[model samples]
Target: MAASIGSLLAEISGVEDPIEELQSLKTALLSIPVSALRDSVSGQRFDVIFSLLDSNEREQVELCVDILERILMALSPVNVVQNYRVELQGGLTHPKETVKILALMQIGRVVEHPDAVTEILNNHDILRGVIHCIGEEMSVAKQAVQSLSKLSHSKPGLDKLFQSDLLNAIKDVMATSDIIRYRIYELLVEISSVSPISLGYCANSSLISQLLSELTGDDILIRATAIEMVTALAHSPHGRQHLSQQGIMDKLSNMIRGAETDPLSSLYLPGLVKFFGNLAIMESPQQVCETYPAFLDKVFEMALDPDPAMIGVALDTLGLLGSTVEGKQILQKTGKKFKAVLLRMSKHGSLGATNLRVRSLDAISQLLTLLPEQQTEDLLALTESWFQLLSNEPMDMIRNIITQPFPELHCSALRIFTAIADQPWGQKLMMSTPGFMEFILDRSTGQTKEAKDGKFQLVGTLAGSSTAAEILGSQHYLRMKTYLREGPYHVTAVATVSTEGAD
Candidate 1:
């Protein structure tokens, strides 16, 4: 089977119609065993496989590199880390662009291997070869630089890749080729995932200035990718300030409001919403209100939108923003409108509708906590309505709302239920639901947010059977007891635990 697979790969690797053969070779390569590749002790056969590569012509070299990519991909994870380090150091100057390309890809494939990247970092020669290749045309340059960026950011003991000369290489490539600059955006995304700290490198190295300048470029991809990288950078304090300076949300909002044929609008909008929300949470709410009033209005428009997803983003943004004082007031003024929409949505809407309702509940919950204590009835009425819906709603929607944004809305809903039990009608409403006891038990003991005894003592206390159990559980149930020890503590305690689940 090994010999037949090798011969087939060889035949396809060197065929006249390289593209078609390359595709077939890629499919066949997946079936080949990595163990067989490592045990290729016949030097003659290995040489024959290597020589089949057409290294002289650009097109052929790319095709051959694609095949080698499949081979390396198959061998990855099983091949020893030291073998890759040795191959990469030796392949850097192997006199063929195709071979160097394959080496760069192999380096990336094995990047997660135990000590492979550490070896590359210690051996500066291989790193320099990768930097030199960054000047190649756009596609190859993108692949090489992205691998280098990932190594520099996430791979431990590879800080040496960020040395002065390599940094200069990234800048030079971005300066010349828009394609390479676009790749910078891709590389930054990978960098952010592995090590969010590396966004600072992109911001400080003048890449951010160039990227923001390119936002107005004719290339829609360049603009969209730039916005994405900028968002990742916004994860840091310095990056957030940089985003503000570039007026990123204004640019993104323009893109959102404008008509772009680009397919990335969906991708762009979610991140943009998240960035604005992060800014609203991190910076002063008054500052956000002062700075981007139109932005705030646009977000509110999204919350009341017909699309469930759009409404969800809008609600999440509002929730994040409502965590601030001025933002809370803004949400309060808009709450009744959003709540009406949510109540309408909950009637016959899909699972997403229920999820959006929970988000609305969370934002309203936050706003209520910030409201004046003497005037909390309006919010209390809305809370009562939401709890009633949760008790009688579909099982899936109830589970989704509880599990979706753990702890935040879950804790808020529990608080609202406890508040409702104080009223005679509220106590009667909760007791009418046959599933109420089972739902509470599921939430308290089934590894959901309420299971954390530290964060959710109230739920446990309300579920504990008798006075002695309540007293015993109450010792460690600080948050729960605090809710109990409040006004009408004794009157609400029995109603809180009333269960009609089973005999």
Candidate 2:
């Protein structure tokens, strides 16, 4: 096997058609298992492969780099990579652009292995060489960015890149060509995601303005990338504060409002919505409501969007806005239409659409709490529509909402239930639902202390209503009474409450 492999390598090095010979060599090398390759040869195969990296022929160099990349990726021995590290690094600055690109590609594969990452990090010049290629031909520049992205995956590799002058090189290349701007933006975003503080250097007024300008560019892809970069920056408080000082909120609000009037502008609506959502975290609900009134209205409109993802995000944004006193007031002013939209969205059937449903219910729950005494009639009217809309699969939907694995959604469902319990008509409607009593009894029997307590409170609330009291006293309440007596002590205490004394 060793003699045959050596024969193949000799043909690859000396053959007239290098590509054909290299392909044959790659096939033969791949046929040998890594263990066999390691045991059979005294590093001669790797030396033969490494010798090609210095060849005058670009095709031979690229083919060798490609083959080496495969070998490195296949869990080859550390010495296999370590022996050629210097040669690979040298190829980064080779006169031929093709060789440099292939070398960078091979280096990317190398760094993907944990063993090679430490070796590569020790050589800062190799990373600097890759960054220097960012200003080369477009294809080469893209390969450089791809390599940098791979290197950025490791904290040490990423730290080396940040400590270097790569950002300045990125800025220079970004200014010269919109062609490579998206790739550069991607690298920046990747770095920011891993080390947000490293991106502080680019958080100045100039870079922010550049990104904001891209937000309004005619190209949708550019706008999308800019949105991603801004989102990454917003991950850090410093980045968020920097963007806020540059009026990011106002710009995002303008983009959102513009999306309302122009369908083309609406292309940025989802990105703008996400960006606005992140920015909202740095702000109080009152500040958000005051800063972006038009944007907030647009968010409510998106809550009913046909796309589940859009509806999910819009619902979350609304929930944030309704998180405060002033924000809740603003949502309430949208009136019954807003409540109706939320109720309709709460019944979405798609799997993983629970968050959207949960957020919609949460927003409605907030509105319920904010409603004044004078709005009791409106509350009853809204609850009637909720029950009617959910009437078809009422039991299934209620079970899903209350039993959701996430505590937030679970609690949000209970909040909606509690809000309904406050309304006289709602209590009667809830008591009459087919699964309503079973749900309460099942919950009362739950092992979790919190669930049992919540169920107890809900049941106690229903027992206060005369209509519910009549229903509870009937034979239908026998199951609950049996569970209370034989079930957990908490359930027994809740069931023993007198209807007259409950309210």
Each prediction's TM-score versus the true structure? 0.50, 0.55
Local accuracy of candidate 2 as per-residue lDDT tens digits, 142-234: 788787877777667655665556556557667777766666666666555554454553343145467667876888767866887788777
Give the lDDT of residue 342 in candidate 2: 57
371-458 per-residue lDDT for model 1 (tens digits): 3232255555644554455435533444445555555445545544443433333434444656553454332333443434322343
Residue 288, model 1: lDDT of: 65
Query: Which 10-residue window of candidate 2 scores lowest in summed lDDT?
Result: 367-376
On lDDT, the leading prediction is 2
Angstrom error at residue 81, model 1: 9.9
CA shift of 285, model 2, Å? 6.4
